[model samples]
Structure formats: C-alpha cells, structure tokens
Target: MELKQETQTYEMPHLLTYYECDETGHPSMSMLLSMISMASDEHSMALGMGIEKVQATGGTWVVSGYEGQLAEQQPVFGETIILGTRAVAYNRFFAVREFWITDKEHNIEYARIKAIFVFMNLKTRRMESIPAALIEPFRSPIVKRIPRLKRPQKLNENAPIVEKDYRVRYFDLDANHHVNNARYFDWLLDPLGRNFLKTHRLKKFNLQYLQEVRDGEKIDSKVNKLIENQKITCHQISSDNQIDAIAEIEWY
Candidate 1:
C-alpha cells in the first residue's frame, strides 16, 4: 500500500441537520456518505482536478464501492462536524480515497470510510484508465495494485427476503447529473421497515454500485435476511430492467 508521502487532505465544517438524521437521531448512513463525498469533491477541486476538469476529459469519476465503519456513538442532529478526505492511491483503472467525520473540535471521530473509484467514458459507459493528470494532482502514488475493497457476495437462493419499490426523486440527483451515490442507502434500508430500523444500528457496512440510477427510474430494493447471522443482512437493488447495486450491512 505504498503511496506518495505528501498525501493532500481537505476538510470542511458541516452541520448535521434534522433531515440528515434518522429516527434514532443519528446521522443516516446515506447522509454520512454524502457529507464525506462533498469533502472528496472539494479536495479534488482544490488540487485542480474538479468536476468540470474531469468531465472535460470526456470521463467522470465513478464510485465502484465503499466500505465504512459506524462508531457506537454516531453524530447527532444540530451538531457541527469536521468532514475530511484525501486521495490515497491509484492503479491504472482504480483510485482509492479515504474519508472521516469528527466533532467540530476534531475529537470523538464518528465514522471512517474507504472507497474505490474508476474513470468511465460517459458516452460509451465503459471503464477507462484513470488519467495521469487526475492522479498526479492528488500527489498519491500510482501503485501497481490499489488496496481492494471487500467484495459483497451474491444473495443465496433460499435466503428469506422482503422488497419494496422507490421512485427516483429530483433531489437525489447530484453534481454529476446522476443519482448521488449516497441516496441509495435509503432504498437499501427502507425494506427493513421502521421498527427494525429504529431498533438496530449499523455497525459495519459495504456497498457496490453496479449501475447508475437516473432520474425517473424506479427501483426494486430487496433485502435478504441471513438467518445464520443475526448481525448480517444483504441487499440487491434493481431497476425495471437491470440490477443497479448490491450491498451488505451488520447491525448491533
């Protein structure tokens, strides 16, 4: 995991608003991802690799997956927190980034995240080698193998499951003109219902984005309960014609 010594980091002050918190009063998983994502974007812009710059190259950074941990004491509404991120490393087609959330005073860190990203040709919708100009700006070394994320296994045929459908709202769109990567969390967790959601808290999580969900698309979010493992649950979200994403979570 060797990377450049001069890893550049950027931080921004963020307030956890009521809408960002779930019924339990903790920042929702999706919202936490969104906050850190904003930090990552800002860091890129500061390094002259901003959204416009990347898009101008005829491609965009696409999140392949994210693996993160939720501390027992999660951030709550109305509290301001420090969101931080830095590019870690990159290979030919993959780049790694890290993110964190801490109290305003920079104490009591609540979450830590590692995500994998790839460059894609927008028109062709195919993977492309990450442009050197993009990676070099972050000062992260171009490594032989970027650290890999935990790959989620496919759901079992006999796994007990429940599902629900959701409509992509206008608000889910982000600067990329696609559904923000974090918005999928609501669909991923909603099938568990309000009762299960309120009683449990996410302790560990992983997600893989297989396809992008655009505005006006409808998704079928399915959850498979792992009877042998009380702490683990698997999810698969599909649009009318394709599987959009798959994820797994551990609750305690």
Candidate 2:
C-alpha cells in the first residue's frame, strides 16, 4: 500500500540511554544518527519495503551524508523522545529523507536532519537505479535530479592538519558489512579528544561520504583549523592517502 503525503511520516518512541550519551550527558552525534537511521528503516518497513524486501531487490540503501543542527534544549539521558522520519523525495538513483527528534508534545525539537541515500548493487557494489516497486510506497515523485544537502566543505590538502588514526573495529561494522556511517562520527570527533568534545557542544554540522571504509581498514582522521573562521574546523578521513570522507563542524 502506498503512503499518502499526509501519512508519509513515521515516528517511534525512544528512551535516551546513558550509553548513548557522552560525558556532557547529551546524545553523541554517532548514536543520534543511528536513531534516525533506525527510524528510517521502520518507516520503510511500514511501507512494505523492509530489510528482507530491500535485500531481495539485490541492492542496499547507502547514506550519502547529513546536514543538521542541534537545538539548545536537547533531551537528556533517560528521557523518552520521539524519533521521526519522512520519505521526502527520490529520483532514479537517489532518495532524500528528513528526520527529527522531538518532545512527546512536539513543542520542542532537539535536532533536525536531511540525508541523501542511494541504492548500491550487492555484488557489484556500484550504485543502481532505485526499483519503482521499492519506492512506490513512499509516494515520492521521480525527478531528473535529486536534491543535495548543504555539503561539507572540502579539506584543503595543502594546509597543515592534525591527524589521528583509527582501526575499523569489529563492532563498527553494521549489517551492510562496512564501517557503519555512524561510526565515522566517532572517528571524526575523537581526534578533538575528550577535553574539547566534553567542553563544547555541536551546534551545526555537515558531512559528505565520498568513499566507504570497510572493516580492518586503517583510517587517518585529519583536522584542519580554518584560518578565516577560528570557530570553525574542517575535517577529512583518508585511507592510504585516499580521502574517504570530508566534513565541517561548528560548536557553541
């Protein structure tokens, strides 16, 4: 059954857990992303394109990246919050989804997200056109060009940058057999170390996943301080000198 625009959104109750929060007692970026990704999956299942059905299509959904902001009033550990997502739009190879976390009353929103997803063929691991049967339920229109989020700025390779290395852990591998998209946040923020992360809060962030990092791969996460904007930091992850991803993060 196709979902009408009026009912295309899906919401599920979530209880913030101590494990999902950082020393600041706020949700970590990685875990928060996992919440919305889970909500997107739930929304898909409700529309009849659950994991099994999607797998049968011989392709899997891949998150290109996300652009979002955190509100000042964030939910604390143990708070029950609402995680919601709406299948916004799609073209042949890409889909756009919007997500949010809000209070039960929905009078307060903790965060808002926009993400781009593409279908990748299982064996070939190359992008493929989204199957009509798969996307028909979402009731989004197909267009020539999919919408692009505010992309993270590219890293200036010529500039001096601080760097740290991370080994893709077994636990970081999600069902897709790759380093989970959420785990990138861990690597991205960890380079700043505990002091900076605990002292400041993320106000806005934009990320772009140019390549995938698989299990057992060593990634060098680098940070370049913006000369013009001291408050802003630019980051990129490279494997064997090849960039896997780039991002821009701002804090308050």
* Winner by TM-score: 2
| lDDT scores of the candidates, listed in order | 0.85, 0.85
TM-score of each: 0.92, 0.94
Residue lDDT tens for model 2, 35-82: 999888888888778899999989989998899988978889999989
RMSD of 2: 2.3
Q: List the residue pairs that clash in candidate 1.
A: none
- Local accuracy of candidate 1 as per-residue lDDT tens digits, 1-252: 112236577788888899989889998888888888888877877766777888999999889999988788888899998898888888999999988888988778888889999999989989999888888878877789777889876766486778799999999897678889899999998998887889888988889999989899999998875354478888889997698999888787
Give me the displacement of residue 5 in model 2, in angstroms: 6.1
lDDT minimum window of 10 residues, candidate 1: 1-10
Q: TM-score of model 2 relative to the true fold?
A: 0.94
> What is the lDDT, from 0 to 100, of the residue 211 in candidate 1?
90
